[model samples]
Target: MQKQDTGKKLTVSLIVLALTVLAAIITRLTGLETTSAKLIGSFAAVFLLTGVVWRFPFRFYCMAFGFEVLAAVLGSALNLYHYLGFYDKFVHYTSGIVLAEGGLILIHALAGRRHTPAEPLLCRLFSMFFAIAGAGIWEIYEFTADNLLGINMQGDNTNTMGDIISGTLGALTWFGIHTLMHKRQQEKQ
Candidate 1:
């Protein structure tokens, strides 16, 4: 990464760290123990992942981090999921986009290390499947949480199917945009 870019990321990370601390303080003060713990853990995970994965695209990292804070922090802390029926699905859908982009970045990074440019088709296929698999994994996690902990995470079959479909559509959205961008580049060449 460029020096300027690194500086920008550092700034963003610091801001997030501050937010995490503030959230912890506020939630604890308000007697929201669960929310406080969740926010701290979620922010920590995002911070560590982004910090460790230095090769990830800056834009993608920002988007991923933003969505996480939005979904995990704002959404949970504000009780958006309970109030807004669409919010949960929206989060799942956006998660698919983030996962797809993460997969693409991972493939590209590996190919770069091997000194071979990844084929476009392979990248697209990997990204799409990765996102779908991620969606499945998320649903499984919800199911496990519900069963093991007796939590109301996964509402029902309808909700699970809807989340998966939303995620698939999100992946398709990214795929379409990527294909169009690649086509434009090919045409220019």
Candidate 2:
């Protein structure tokens, strides 16, 4: 692949680094509550991860990093806002995250390289495998974060199932998206 003028990459990474540092400074100065601190910390992680993409353009990593940063920012916002008496509850956060994560996983899977691996049926299977596996690994991370850190990410068992199901739906959504993109690509040829 031709080397991209990743001065933009460096610039973006620097912006994230600055944001991470700024979040640290603002939190220290404001002396916010526990939730606020956690949220800021989440953003810090997001920025730091994004800042590292200067090394390579691995599509999965890039998408994962970007999605995760967004997830942290929005997730932390949900916790802080709801607890600060803005919303009635924090449950909405989990659902929104599940949907969003699923979408990200699908986008990631579709964007990845597809080597003509097998027959049409097998190709479909392989495609689904990557999408499902990617989404499932993310869910596994959520489980680990919940069980190990006491975060109640899944909420209820039923809700957890729903989230998993929704994630699969998100993968399906990506299939549609990728199909359209592939069609456009073929048309250009």
Candidate 3:
């Protein structure tokens, strides 16, 4: 059943990638030069990253990350962020959650069978730290792009601060849910 689900997810992800490619082509043909280039480059980067994630043993995490990337790219391509004021915040929050999941999966893989269940506190801390660090790096990238490429990736200091806060809150939210789920599972056992 899990394998079947994973297969279905992979198929959907592939379809999303195809659609993104089509959108990029359309954007290019329509003469939206800046948007076309940005869409194409973002799609390519996301596609390559998804490919790398696919190699990992954690199928679910890979799929989650792939979907998150696709959604982010789609939002950018369609100008959703411009139309919907909160769309950018949504993406940042989702990125934090997805990245935290990736961090947890990494820790799980490293722990191996010897540690069937790794230390919960350590896992939570690592995941939160990873999300926060990723958010910081992304801000740095936005700042650099805005200055060097003359793109306004970071609208203002308030926007930057809001993104960081949203990301951190997302990580904390994940931790809370994870703790609850773990406790529930323990109670069941």
Q: Residue by residue across 1-189, what tens digits does model 2's lDDT show?
A: 225535555455565556555655655676644366665677667657655544544453445444544445433533343345422123223333333434444444454655433343334434554555655666688789999999776566665565556556555555555567667878999
The CA-based lDDT of model 1 is what?
A: 0.80
Off by over 4 Å in 3: 1-9, 21-34, 57-71, 113-117
Candidate 3 residue-wise lDDT, 1-189, digit = tens: 357656765775676677677667765676543465568666775566656665455555455655545454556665567767898888888778877887788788777856677898798789888988888899999999999999898999999999998888878887888888888988999
Q: Is candidate 1 or candidate 3 better by TM-score?
A: 1
Q: Taking the tens digit of each residue's C-alpha lDDT, what string does model 1 give over 1-189?
A: 788888877777777667666666676777753564577566776667576655667888687777767676656754567768899889888888988898898899899999998999889889988999999999999999999999988899999999999888888888888999999999999
Return the clash pairs for model 1, or none. Answer: none
Per-residue error at 17 for model 3, in Å?
1.7
Give stretches of model 2 more than 4 Å off: 1-5, 18-40, 47-65, 77-128
Candidate 3 lDDT (Cα, 0 to 1): 0.74
Candidate 3 pairs with clashing backbones: none
| Model 3 CA RMSD to the hidden true structure, in angstroms | 3.5
lDDT (0-100) at residue 1 of candidate 3? 31
Ranking by TM-score: 1, 3, 2
By TM-score, the best candidate is 1
TM-score of 3: 0.80
**Model 1 stretches astray by more than 4 angstroms:** 18-34, 52-55
